[model samples]
Target: MFWQWLTAPWQYEFMVRAILLSVVVGLVCGALSCYMVLRGWALMGDAISHAVLPGVILAHVLNLPLALGAFVFGVGSVLTIGFVESQTRIKEDTVIGIVFTGFFALGLVLLSKVKSTIDLTHILFGNVLGISNTDIYQTVISSVVTLTILFLRQRDFLLFCFDPTHARSIGINTNLFHYLLLSLLSLTAVAGLQAVGIILVVAMLITPGATAYLLTDRFDRMLGLAMGLGAAAAIVGNYVSFYLDVATGGCIVLVQTLLFGLAVFFAPKHGILARKFWAKIDL
Candidate 1:
């Protein structure tokens, strides 16, 4: 049944690139996403995703490298958060609210300036089904960079993630790790944006990790499960979109949602339905 992808004319170089890109992106994002979710930085992921919009729009307007611009903005957003938290009396949610809205508003203005193009939907929602050669390279580079950094400091990262105070007690530069992790998150979000857009990037960064948490007991195992689940979602979503001629990012995100729901209802030790069934047996 799946052999059609090999023979179909539509499954050319670009199609292969999209599938490969999704696999790499899903794997890397899912790994880091578990850390973000566990550390309660899920909203931070959402804020970073939205905050990069202006960078993208300005890049498109200036005809510059979109990835570079987006990366700068992503880093800028994380910096802005640190600055605001230190300087202002406002709470974190308030800061995220102000920053993301302002950035997204700036993006809207820039997009309107480039109003000549009627096909701007891709900027907001992505076009994974129509990935380009350049996009493949961008995704691969970002994924590799993320993996390299993550691998090099895997132990430090684990300590920093599980307990920053303890990490600092051990002479680990906790702030450095935190900002560096933010940089990785920014890069991943920017790379995924081309294929999945800004908002869906939040789903990608959060849902797979959550689903994996339900399926695994160990942190490393959870990351592996999350990556595997993400790959499955991406591949299945692509196939579904190809046959139904639907939105690629949306389908993939919906797949993630379904996976999470299944985990919630059926996980062995912690699931709602499973717990209830066990309670009935005990009674």
Candidate 2:
């Protein structure tokens, strides 16, 4: 009965597509999540995810690809935040807050005014089961490009995230990598829009890496663990959503959160239980 239950969702074509795309989004987001965590850019991920709203609306109005608009707005918000922070006494976080909220508000206004078939609720919360072929293509292409770049520049990115001052002293173009990471983040967020939508996409981009962080100190291991956890959560969450009739994206993120919670108490070196055990032994 358990095996049959597991196999039932796969019989539907939509389930297959949802699982595939969710896994792809999970892997890419997981990989990028490492960099974001190491670099202390969690809020940036949230910023970009929210900021892409206006671009998506514009894309629909212009009859262009939503991913393109999302990327542009995502990148644009980053650049805007950088520029504003540099020119004023404002901190980056404040600038990011202002920019993303403003863009998000603009997007809401556009959504209200635009006479189109775009479902605002779906855009915010996601509709992975209803994903179209075109969305699948866009998501796959974006994931491929984001993952390829991340893999090729893995070492450099690690150095930059770990110690930017040292990376700059060693002659790495920190500026170039700064924008590169942001761009890739934007693209990844765009790819994830179809799976988890904008509001929850930041969780997909963050939780896996965070969960892995508790499990290992090594960045490479963290990366692998995060990706594995993310993909597993995607598959399991999708199945749960199918049987329970819940929101797929929410289920996926909740699964990730559950893993993170487990790691918090059970991880070997960093977890609460481990520390407690070691402390008792010392006593």
Candidate 3:
């Protein structure tokens, strides 16, 4: 019975697709997350994830590709936040909160005005099992593009995140990388939508990276660890969800969260227990 249960998720084509999608989304989100964590952009990830909602609704109305609408709004939200921060005395966090909430509310209002053809639950929470061939293709393309750009420009992005002024001093176009990172964030969010939807996508973007951060001091190791954790979480979460009959996306997020908790308390060098142990030794 245990062996059968282990093999269950693989017996179906939908499961195969879900597993593939989960890996793709996990890898992209996990890799990008290291940068987000280092740059203190966790809230920014949340902002883009929620801000894409209005574009999703608009796309549904116009019968356009959901990815297109989502990408536009995601980028729009980042730009709006940037403009607001530059023009006012308000902090970046405040600007992000305002813009993202306003955009989210607008999406809700638009959703209400339209007929009930759209599945609000699916849009908000996602239905990974219901993924179509087109979604798979789009996700694959988006993942490839996003990952390729990130890998190729890793040095520039790292410099930009750690010290934008220094990057500018060195003649790197900091502004370009700034907007490029935002664009990639949007792209990754859209790719994640089909797996976990807008709500849980932020977790995927932040948790793996944060967990990896706890585990390692090096950025390259952080990236590798995050991706491995993400992929493992997705696989285990999907398998568990299949037997438990729970929401697949939520299960994946839950697994990632659990892993993060474990890392926090048990990581060899940086965990809470480790720090306390070292403190006791010093005394």
> How well does candidate 1 match the true structure in TM-score terms?
0.92
Error (Å) of candidate 1 at residue 11 is 3.5
The C-alpha local distance difference test score for the whole of candidate 3 amounts to: 0.91
TM-score winner, 2 or 3? 2
User: Higher-TM-score candidate among 1 and 2?
Assistant: 2
Clashing pairs in 1: none
Residues 120-189, candidate 2: write the lDDT tens digits. Answer: 9888989999998988998899899999999999999999888899999989999999999998998888
Query: Which parts of model 2 have CA positions greater than 4 angstroms off?
Result: none
CA deviation > 4 Å runs, candidate 3: none
lDDT comparing candidate 2 with the true structure: 0.92
Judged by lDDT, which candidate is best? 2
The Cα RMSD of model 2 versus the native structure comes to 1.0
Q: Give the alpha carbon lDDT tens digit for every residue of 169-250 in model 3.
A: 9899998998888888888888887788889999999999999999999889999999999889999989888988899999
Models 1 onward score TM values of 0.92, 0.97, 0.96
Window of ten residues with lowest summed lDDT in model 1: 5-14
Which structure among the candidates has the greatest TM-score? 2
Name every residue pair that clashes in candidate 2: none
Worst 10 residues of 2 by lDDT: 113-122
lDDT of 1 by residue, 201-249 (tens): 9888999999988877898888789889888888877767767878888
Residue 90, model 2: lDDT of 95
